[model samples]
Target: MENHKLGRAPDFTNACIVMFGVNLGWVLLFLFAIYGLVAAVFICLIVNHWLNWVAVRRRQADQLYAGKTPG
Candidate 1:
Protein backbone atom coordinates (compact mmCIF):
# COMPACT_ATOMS: atom_id res chain seq x y z
CA MET A 1 0.00 0.00 0.00
CA GLU A 2 1.11 3.59 -0.56
CA ASN A 3 0.50 4.58 3.05
CA HIS A 4 2.55 1.60 4.35
CA LYS A 5 5.47 2.43 2.07
CA LEU A 6 5.45 6.08 3.10
CA GLY A 7 5.59 5.23 6.78
CA ARG A 8 8.46 2.80 6.29
CA ALA A 9 10.42 5.33 4.29
CA PRO A 10 10.25 7.93 7.03
CA ASP A 11 11.43 5.40 9.59
CA PHE A 12 14.50 4.59 7.53
CA THR A 13 15.25 8.26 6.97
CA ASN A 14 14.91 9.04 10.66
CA ALA A 15 17.33 6.23 11.56
CA CYS A 16 19.87 7.54 9.10
CA ILE A 17 19.54 11.06 10.43
CA VAL A 18 20.11 9.90 13.99
CA MET A 19 23.21 7.98 12.97
CA PHE A 20 24.60 11.00 11.16
CA GLY A 21 23.94 13.28 14.15
CA VAL A 22 25.77 10.96 16.55
CA ASN A 23 28.78 10.71 14.27
CA LEU A 24 28.93 14.47 13.89
CA GLY A 25 28.73 14.97 17.67
CA TRP A 26 31.66 12.60 18.25
CA VAL A 27 33.77 14.41 15.68
CA LEU A 28 33.12 17.78 17.28
CA LEU A 29 33.92 16.36 20.71
CA PHE A 30 37.28 15.07 19.51
CA LEU A 31 38.15 18.39 17.93
CA PHE A 32 37.33 20.28 21.11
CA ALA A 33 39.42 17.84 23.18
CA ILE A 34 42.43 18.45 20.98
CA TYR A 35 41.97 22.20 21.18
CA GLY A 36 41.78 22.04 24.98
CA LEU A 37 45.00 20.02 25.16
CA VAL A 38 46.86 22.51 23.00
CA ALA A 39 45.58 25.40 25.06
CA ALA A 40 46.79 23.69 28.25
CA VAL A 41 50.25 23.21 26.82
CA PHE A 42 50.43 26.87 25.85
CA ILE A 43 49.36 27.94 29.34
CA CYS A 44 52.08 25.74 30.88
CA LEU A 45 54.74 27.35 28.72
CA ILE A 46 53.60 30.85 29.72
CA VAL A 47 53.64 29.95 33.39
CA ASN A 48 57.14 28.49 33.08
CA HIS A 49 58.39 31.69 31.48
CA TRP A 50 56.85 33.79 34.24
CA LEU A 51 58.46 31.66 36.94
CA ASN A 52 61.86 31.94 35.30
CA TRP A 53 61.50 35.70 35.07
CA VAL A 54 60.69 35.91 38.75
CA ALA A 55 63.75 33.85 39.62
CA VAL A 56 65.99 36.04 37.50
CA ARG A 57 64.64 39.20 39.11
CA ARG A 58 65.24 37.79 42.56
CA ARG A 59 68.81 36.94 41.70
CA GLN A 60 69.41 40.44 40.34
CA ALA A 61 68.01 41.99 43.50
CA ASP A 62 70.26 39.80 45.62
CA GLN A 63 73.29 40.82 43.60
CA LEU A 64 72.48 44.52 43.90
CA TYR A 65 72.13 44.25 47.68
CA ALA A 66 75.37 42.26 48.00
CA GLY A 67 77.30 44.85 45.89
CA LYS A 68 78.32 42.22 43.33
CA THR A 69 77.46 41.65 39.62
CA PRO A 70 75.34 38.58 38.90
CA GLY A 71 77.35 36.06 36.88
Candidate 2:
Protein backbone atom coordinates (compact mmCIF):
# COMPACT_ATOMS: atom_id res chain seq x y z
CA MET A 1 0.00 0.00 0.00
CA GLU A 2 2.86 2.34 0.89
CA ASN A 3 4.54 1.66 -2.40
CA HIS A 4 1.29 2.26 -4.28
CA LYS A 5 0.81 5.58 -2.50
CA LEU A 6 4.39 6.58 -3.25
CA GLY A 7 3.93 5.72 -6.87
CA ARG A 8 0.73 7.72 -7.00
CA ALA A 9 2.37 10.81 -5.61
CA PRO A 10 2.81 13.34 -8.37
CA ASP A 11 6.38 13.53 -9.69
CA PHE A 12 6.50 17.25 -9.10
CA THR A 13 10.27 17.17 -8.82
CA ASN A 14 10.51 16.13 -12.43
CA ALA A 15 8.20 19.00 -13.42
CA CYS A 16 9.76 21.54 -11.06
CA ILE A 17 11.15 23.71 -13.88
CA VAL A 18 7.75 24.12 -15.44
CA MET A 19 6.20 24.94 -12.07
CA PHE A 20 8.90 27.53 -11.43
CA GLY A 21 8.18 29.17 -14.77
CA VAL A 22 4.49 29.39 -13.95
CA ASN A 23 5.26 30.83 -10.50
CA LEU A 24 7.57 33.51 -11.96
CA GLY A 25 4.93 34.50 -14.49
CA TRP A 26 2.38 35.00 -11.72
CA VAL A 27 4.84 37.04 -9.65
CA LEU A 28 5.50 39.40 -12.54
CA LEU A 29 1.81 39.79 -13.19
CA PHE A 30 1.12 40.61 -9.54
CA LEU A 31 3.93 43.17 -9.45
CA PHE A 32 2.64 44.88 -12.58
CA ALA A 33 -0.86 45.10 -11.06
CA ILE A 34 0.52 46.71 -7.91
CA TYR A 35 2.59 49.14 -10.00
CA GLY A 36 -0.45 50.16 -12.02
CA LEU A 37 -2.52 50.89 -8.92
CA VAL A 38 0.25 52.98 -7.38
CA ALA A 39 0.74 54.92 -10.60
CA ALA A 40 -2.97 55.69 -10.86
CA VAL A 41 -3.07 57.00 -7.29
CA PHE A 42 -0.04 59.18 -7.98
CA ILE A 43 -1.68 60.67 -11.07
CA CYS A 44 -4.86 61.41 -9.13
CA LEU A 45 -2.90 63.18 -6.41
CA ILE A 46 -1.09 65.38 -8.95
CA VAL A 47 -4.29 66.38 -10.68
CA ASN A 48 -5.99 67.17 -7.39
CA HIS A 49 -3.10 69.38 -6.36
CA TRP A 50 -3.17 71.27 -9.64
CA LEU A 51 -6.91 71.90 -9.38
CA ASN A 52 -6.60 73.20 -5.83
CA TRP A 53 -3.78 75.52 -6.86
CA VAL A 54 -5.82 76.93 -9.72
CA ALA A 55 -8.83 77.53 -7.49
CA VAL A 56 -6.71 79.35 -4.90
CA ARG A 57 -5.05 81.50 -7.56
CA ARG A 58 -8.40 82.43 -9.05
CA ARG A 59 -9.74 83.45 -5.62
CA GLN A 60 -6.67 85.55 -4.94
CA ALA A 61 -7.02 87.31 -8.29
CA ASP A 62 -10.70 88.02 -7.63
CA GLN A 63 -9.94 89.43 -4.18
CA LEU A 64 -7.18 91.65 -5.59
CA TYR A 65 -9.48 93.09 -8.29
CA ALA A 66 -12.58 93.46 -6.05
CA GLY A 67 -11.10 96.74 -4.79
CA LYS A 68 -12.05 99.42 -7.38
CA THR A 69 -10.00 98.98 -10.55
CA PRO A 70 -10.54 100.33 -14.09
CA GLY A 71 -7.15 99.57 -15.68
Candidate 3:
Protein backbone atom coordinates (compact mmCIF):
# COMPACT_ATOMS: atom_id res chain seq x y z
CA MET A 1 0.00 0.00 0.00
CA GLU A 2 2.98 2.28 0.53
CA ASN A 3 3.56 2.56 -3.22
CA HIS A 4 -0.11 3.24 -3.90
CA LYS A 5 -1.03 6.40 -5.72
CA LEU A 6 -4.07 8.64 -5.34
CA GLY A 7 -5.68 9.47 -8.71
CA ARG A 8 -4.37 6.77 -11.04
CA ALA A 9 -5.71 3.27 -11.82
CA PRO A 10 -5.60 0.34 -9.38
CA ASP A 11 -5.07 2.65 -6.41
CA PHE A 12 -7.66 5.28 -7.30
CA THR A 13 -10.62 3.55 -5.73
CA ASN A 14 -8.77 2.89 -2.51
CA ALA A 15 -7.57 6.48 -2.40
CA CYS A 16 -11.07 7.74 -3.06
CA ILE A 17 -12.44 5.71 -0.19
CA VAL A 18 -9.84 7.11 2.17
CA MET A 19 -10.59 10.62 0.99
CA PHE A 20 -14.36 10.13 1.42
CA GLY A 21 -13.91 9.12 5.02
CA VAL A 22 -11.62 12.03 5.81
CA ASN A 23 -13.93 14.56 4.20
CA LEU A 24 -16.96 13.09 5.94
CA GLY A 25 -15.32 12.84 9.33
CA TRP A 26 -12.90 15.74 9.76
CA VAL A 27 -14.35 18.32 7.41
CA LEU A 28 -17.88 17.72 8.62
CA LEU A 29 -16.75 17.79 12.20
CA PHE A 30 -15.53 21.33 11.74
CA LEU A 31 -18.48 22.31 9.60
CA PHE A 32 -20.90 21.07 12.23
CA ALA A 33 -19.23 23.18 14.83
CA ILE A 34 -19.24 26.27 12.65
CA TYR A 35 -22.45 25.96 10.61
CA GLY A 36 -24.50 23.49 12.69
CA LEU A 37 -26.55 20.49 11.53
CA VAL A 38 -28.63 21.72 8.62
CA ALA A 39 -25.83 23.36 6.68
CA ALA A 40 -23.55 20.40 7.29
CA VAL A 41 -26.18 18.02 5.89
CA PHE A 42 -26.34 20.00 2.67
CA ILE A 43 -22.56 20.11 2.40
CA CYS A 44 -22.38 16.39 3.03
CA LEU A 45 -24.86 15.68 0.25
CA ILE A 46 -22.93 17.81 -2.23
CA VAL A 47 -19.63 16.26 -1.28
CA ASN A 48 -21.07 12.77 -1.57
CA HIS A 49 -22.31 13.42 -5.08
CA TRP A 50 -19.00 14.95 -6.18
CA LEU A 51 -16.95 12.08 -4.81
CA ASN A 52 -19.19 9.46 -6.40
CA TRP A 53 -19.10 11.26 -9.72
CA VAL A 54 -15.33 11.47 -9.67
CA ALA A 55 -15.05 7.80 -8.80
CA VAL A 56 -17.32 6.91 -11.69
CA ARG A 57 -15.25 8.96 -14.09
CA ARG A 58 -12.06 7.30 -12.95
CA ARG A 59 -13.55 3.82 -13.25
CA GLN A 60 -14.80 4.48 -16.76
CA ALA A 61 -11.42 5.75 -17.77
CA ASP A 62 -9.84 2.62 -16.43
CA GLN A 63 -12.19 0.46 -18.50
CA LEU A 64 -11.44 2.43 -21.62
CA TYR A 65 -7.71 2.13 -21.13
CA ALA A 66 -7.97 -1.58 -20.47
CA GLY A 67 -9.60 -2.15 -23.87
CA LYS A 68 -7.14 -0.07 -25.87
CA THR A 69 -4.15 -1.73 -27.54
CA PRO A 70 -0.70 -0.43 -26.69
CA GLY A 71 0.61 1.98 -29.29
Model 1, position 71: C-alpha lDDT score: 78
Relative to the true structure, how large is the alpha-carbon lDDT of every model? 0.75, 0.70, 0.83
* lDDT (tens digit, per residue) of candidate 3 on 1-71: 99977885464888887997887798888989999998889987998899899988888888778995333
Across residues 1-71, which tens digit of lDDT does each residue of candidate 2 receive?
55654436577785896887688567656756878667656655776798899988888788778974322
What is candidate 1's lDDT per residue for 18-45, written digit by digit as tens? Answer: 9976885675567558776566566557
lDDT of 3: 0.83
TM-scores for all predictions: 0.49, 0.46, 0.54
Question: Residue 70 in candidate 2 has what lDDT?
Answer: 28
Q: After superposition, how far is residue 43 of candidate 2 from its true place, in Å?
A: 0.5
Worst 10 residues of 2 by lDDT: 1-10
Ten-residue stretch with the least lDDT total in model 1: 2-11
Number of the top TM-score candidate:
3
Poorly placed runs, candidate 1 (over 4 Å): 1-35
Q: Candidate 3, which segments miss by more than 4 Å at Cα?
A: 1-24, 68-71
Q: Give the winner by TM-score: 1 or 2.
A: 1
lDDT comparing candidate 2 with the true structure = 0.70
